[model samples]
Target: MTIKVLVADDHAAVRAGIVLILDGAADLEVVGEAADGEQAVAMARELRPDVVVMDIRMPRLDGISATRELAGVTDVLILTTFDIDEYVFGALRAGAAGFLLKNTDADGLVGAVRLVARGDGMISPGVTRKLISAFAAQPAREPSTRDLSVLTAREQEVLACIARGLSNAEIAGELDMAEATTKTHVSRVLGKLGLKSRVQAAIFYSESG
Candidate 1:
């Protein structure tokens, strides 16, 4: 399947450049572009791209807020110039599937888009320390651990994998289960927990752990 992507950045040149690189790939297409955070959200809802290449800084709104607003609607891969941008953690909390440096090479950029499109997550190694420190400094919230006992063992396992950022196929592989069975388990877990997406599941585990 061709992976549709939405490129959002304030700089016209940057957005055009991303499109040039992505459009060259046989398996990828730039379905849309947005010049700011608000436009990003609107275009995302309108086009429903598989992935969004988002910037950290933009006028009218910021990437973190846009990421929060669009979480679960589409995968967000943050493209930022700063290695240690403060907004990276917020984007993660908002369910961004990947984080990348603006200076990342063309191949890395394409790989990130494709990975996230396939329901995987990634971050550049250079910025891993900053992300770790940011996650560590924040006081973890106390999630409602009591009510989760109602879930069956299989459901619990699915939830754990979701929290770890695994796609349905990945979970199936890890559990020696079929892909269809994995979907049923994930749906069951979501229904039981009253959660909308894996991002929430991940946050719950992060706090509970």
Candidate 2:
């Protein structure tokens, strides 16, 4: 299936550039564009695209708020000019699939969109050290910590793999489970733990140790 995408950025040139690259992909389509956060939210509801490339800062509404609202409605891959640690931290907190720097090369941008469309998150390796350490510093007493006992043993095993940065396909292979079943398990982990993204779950797992 061709993944339909909504590009939301305040700058006309930026949106056009994204459309140019995305429209070139044979299996991807840009069905809509929004110039601000409010329009991004509205467009997602109206067009129901599979993915939304959101900007962290925009007029009318910031990307975080829009991301919060659009979380389950559509996957959000933050497309922002800021590559600061705080931006990545907040975007992930808002349940964004990942963060993409505006100056990213064409191949990197296209890969990010495709990865998010596949229900996977993308984080740049440049920020990996900061993110891993920041999340590691989170207190164990923090509210998002969940009780792993609630999950079946296999589910707990799958959740741990997710925390360890394994993709659903990798988890399936590691667990000798079907990919479909692996997705179901991953979703159940998120729902049961009140977690938003794998990043959050990873934080909990690392902090719990």
Candidate 3:
């Protein structure tokens, strides 16, 4: 199935570049473009694209806030030049399905959109380790009120692998299970934890520690 996408960036040139690359992919289509956060939200609600490629520092709402507003509406992929802790944490907390640096290559950009559209999460490889370490170093937040006990033992193992940033195939290999089984465990874990995506599950595990 073709994945519809909305590109949002304040810079016209940058927005055009993103649209060009996404439109190049056979399975991806650029349905619309937005120049700012408000426009992004408006377009997203109207177009209901599979993914929205967003920039952080727009004039009106900012990507994080727009992401917050878009939480259950559509998945968001934050593609921005900033890799600072604030933006990274902010976007994820705001419910972005993926976070990527603007320096990412065309293929990486295409891959990230596809991954988010598949209900998975992607963080730029360059920033993933640092983001996890920083999150671990911060004083632990209050324990999650969500009950992890609801998950089966296998599902718990899957959650741990997610916190370690393992892909579905890696989790399957690690646990000596099939990849399809791993995906089922992952879906159950998220559903039981009341989480939106793998990224949120990872954060929950971190906060629970």
Q: Largest lDDT belongs to which candidate?
A: 3
Model 1 reaches what TM-score against the true structure?
Answer: 0.82
Clashes of each: 0, 0, 0
Q: Which lDDT values do the candidates have, in the order given?
A: 0.84, 0.84, 0.90
RMSD of 2: 2.1
Instruction: Judge candidate 3 at residue 47 and give its lDDT.
Output: 96
List model 3 lDDT by residue over 55-140, tens digit each: 99999889999999998799999999989989988888888889999999999999999988866789998779877688768885
Model 2 C-alpha lDDT versus the unseen true structure: 0.84
Error of 2 at 88 (Å): 1.6
Candidate 2 clashes between residue pairs 3 or more apart in a chain or in different chains? none
Per-residue lDDT value at 17 in model 2: 93
TM-score for candidate 2, residues paired by index: 0.92
Specify the highest-TM-score model's number.
2
| 1 against 3, candidate with superior lDDT | 3
Q: What is the lDDT of residue 86 in candidate 3?
A: 90
Compared with the true structure, the alpha-carbon lDDT of candidate 3 equals 0.90
How would you encode candidate 1's per-residue C-alpha lDDT over 1-209 as one tens digit per residue? 89999999999999999999999999999999999999999999999999999998899999989998996588899999976566766777677878898889999999989877866677888767776676689986766667578799888888889887788889999999998798788767756776545555665667766
